[model samples]
Target: MVAVYGGRGPQTSNIQIRSIPSVVRRGENVELLCEVENEPDAAISWQRVDGDLPYGAESYGSILRIPSIQGGGIYMCSATTRQGIFDERFGLVIQEEFKRIVKLFIVNNISHSTSEVGKSK
Candidate 1:
């Protein structure tokens, strides 16, 4: 089969965050990946909708890394091209770390002893 090529066909601008995390632990670090499909030259940018990016955060290309959860919130990823600007929003929730408690019971010939470890407050 033979194929014919056309000159600079119409293109649709699109952007997305690939496999972005919706929930993050408190004080935990997160990395968000922004992708622009069909437009490699399109400029991509990231921003936090509720507040500024986390302190010490880094951004390059299609990646946005948050050093910690102090600035976790809605994030916006935008891609700009000659057609227009495409953007997507990602929601991140910060949750307090949960602790699991375990209890051990020991029985002797005539006595029983109980102990608890890492009890949650």
Candidate 2:
């Protein structure tokens, strides 16, 4: 008689995007990482969920690098294997310096106007 042991088949799970920066400045380069627990032979692909895939997007294994972060939105990475497919999402936020400066100017003007009203009374 021959003895054989059966084990679970190939599956993809635990797909995650790692080390996303909390803040990213406009026009800066950024890298987004994707990781998945899957069969050894699984393949990974990356996509932009919000807009057309960036022109400079490049992928090496599980890492995707964007030459410049022009806009803020969601990106997706997917892992595919013979057994199944799994995917995860990451969000990039771009902060524009011009917006901050304009906000500061408005705030200063409001403060000055309030102070003048108080002095008039």
Candidate 3:
């Protein structure tokens, strides 16, 4: 198999990752979309930063879906066509303090009235 594009005519292919904000909260589902354009058939593989091996799929491009966010890490996708193989990686991080603040706000709202929480001295 060819690593890069190798065809009769000029070969060209592009791969990109599309999704919402890079920073996401834990327990949220994230969909990683890979868009690719090439000749007839192309192979795509997606793996997390700590992934073991690559999984293969047939098509110009594809999407990798994450059911829920467990931890912070990076994700990668590699595409191989008649032309060539290209790889890209994306990173994710958890904002623990910010999330904690949000949780606190939610708890306070449920337990106490806003006026009580913000009473005048």
Candidate 4:
């Protein structure tokens, strides 16, 4: 991740978050990832803009797990190193309707093959 810190920030190795756009079905597995890299490790914290968070959910590195699919909104992660704490925020929107679009594009290439088979038959 490439990130910018303000006002006497820490000497971070890589201060950036990778962009991950997930398209998942409801009642299934979904994982959202935000990563940060720094020397000597950094203290990381996560907070959801809306909704509740599961208890005892902390990791050694700058990683957070949603565990289950649920409602979504903006989320932010901050890292505190020897210099200063750097922060990054990202928006997430979850909707069932969009799952169909994902299914169509990701899975149903079968339609194209079926049409070809029909022509041969």
**Deviating ranges (above 4 Å) for candidate 2:** 1-12, 99-121
Candidate maximizing TM-score: 1
Q: Per-residue lDDT for 1-121 in model 4, tens only? A: 4445657773345555443664544454444455655444677777765655534444446666665555566667777766667777766656575434444455654544334454653
Where's the lowest-lDDT run of ten residues in candidate 1? 1-10
How would you encode candidate 3's per-residue C-alpha lDDT over 53-112 as one tens digit per residue? 223322234777665566767778787765667777878665553434444444444565
lDDT for each residue of candidate 1 in 15-90, tens digit (9 for 90 to 100) = 7786445777888878889877677888889888888887888889789887766745788988776667778899
- In model 2, which range of ten residues has the least summed lDDT? 1-10
Off by over 4 Å in 1: 1-10, 100-121
Per-residue error (Å), model 3, residue 18: 1.2
Q: Is candidate 2 or candidate 3 better by TM-score?
A: 2
Q: Tell me each candidate's TM-score.
A: 0.68, 0.66, 0.59, 0.54
Compute the lDDT of residue 12 as modeled in candidate 1.
61
* CA lDDT of each prediction against the hidden true structure: 0.76, 0.73, 0.64, 0.58
Tell me how far candidate 4 lies from the true structure as C-alpha RMSD in angstroms: 13.9
Stretches of model 3 off by over 4 angstroms after superposition: 1-10, 51-61, 97-121
The lowest-lDDT stretch of 10 consecutive residues in candidate 4 is 109-118
